[model samples]
Target: MYFGASASALQRLVEQLKLEAAVERIKVSQAAAELQQYCMQKACKDALLVGEPRSCALF
Candidate 1:
């Protein structure tokens, strides 16, 4: 998953899902270029978590 700002953005997303305890791993990134590369490498086709519905298409 990619968060726009800081790790807190990811934290909030986890909190929203109420799956904090279920999450076994977490990776945080603020660099847009790095995030884009990571996502592309992972072949991430969709945003699993996002603050806004419209942002889902970003993945």
Candidate 2:
């Protein structure tokens, strides 16, 4: 579960839900990079944009 909130907020939510060991938070940039890499590995021509696999706007 990638949260778009502050670290403190994410922590609080995790604690509230008691999912400390189940969920992990990552930066948007890192997630985007990973998504792009996975897409490339699968040869997704439209992974990012039409005919532009490298031009991702994931952020």
Candidate 3:
């Protein structure tokens, strides 16, 4: 029973990680879209976008 439970838990954990990674990709793409929109606005206002921009660097 313990072995079965352990295997089940491990399978669930793997599934969760896969889901999280998929969600992370969605989030990073969203963030990049937002960042691009922001930079475009900033550029329009200042002619040169500048700042310690946010990172969307994935693991």
Candidate 4:
């Protein structure tokens, strides 16, 4: 029936949306991790330049 076909199409759309959402989440997580790494590296470089051994010890 037409109703059954409509329901199937709706289900497919929902699944595609879910997949896209998951991909977005992964991308966001990766970006956040990269940002954290950059921040840590910058902090370490700064500490080293200032000769602050104690500050760099946290890494």
Error of 1 at 23 (Å): 17
- The TM-score measured for candidate 4 stands at 0.33
Residue 31 shift from truth in candidate 3, angstroms:
5.5
Model 3, span 1-59: residue lDDT tens = 44657877988988998998887455878999999998877785552344445564574
Q: Please give the RMSD to the true structure for each candidate, in Å.
A: 16.4, 11.7, 10.0, 10.1
Which predicted model would earn the best TM-score? 2
Shift of residue 39 alpha carbon in model 4, Å: 25
Taking all chains together, each candidate's TM-score versus the true structure is 0.25, 0.41, 0.33, 0.33
Model 1 RMSD in Å is: 16.4
Query: Between the candidate structures 1 and 3, which one is better when assessed by TM-score?
Result: 3
Off by over 4 Å in 3: 1-5, 24-59
Tens-place lDDT per residue, model 4, 1-59, is 44657877988988998998887445878999999899887885675556874643457
Question: Model-by-model lDDT, in order?
Answer: 0.66, 0.76, 0.73, 0.76
Worst 10 residues of 4 by lDDT: 49-58
Least lDDT summed over 10 consecutive residues: which range in candidate 1? 49-58
Report how far residue 32 has shifted in candidate 1, in Å: 45
Higher lDDT: candidate 3 or 4?
Answer: 4
Q: Which stretches of candidate 2 lie over 4 Å from their true place?
A: 1-16, 44-59
Query: Considering lDDT, which of the candidate structures 1 and 3 is the better prediction for this target?
Result: 3
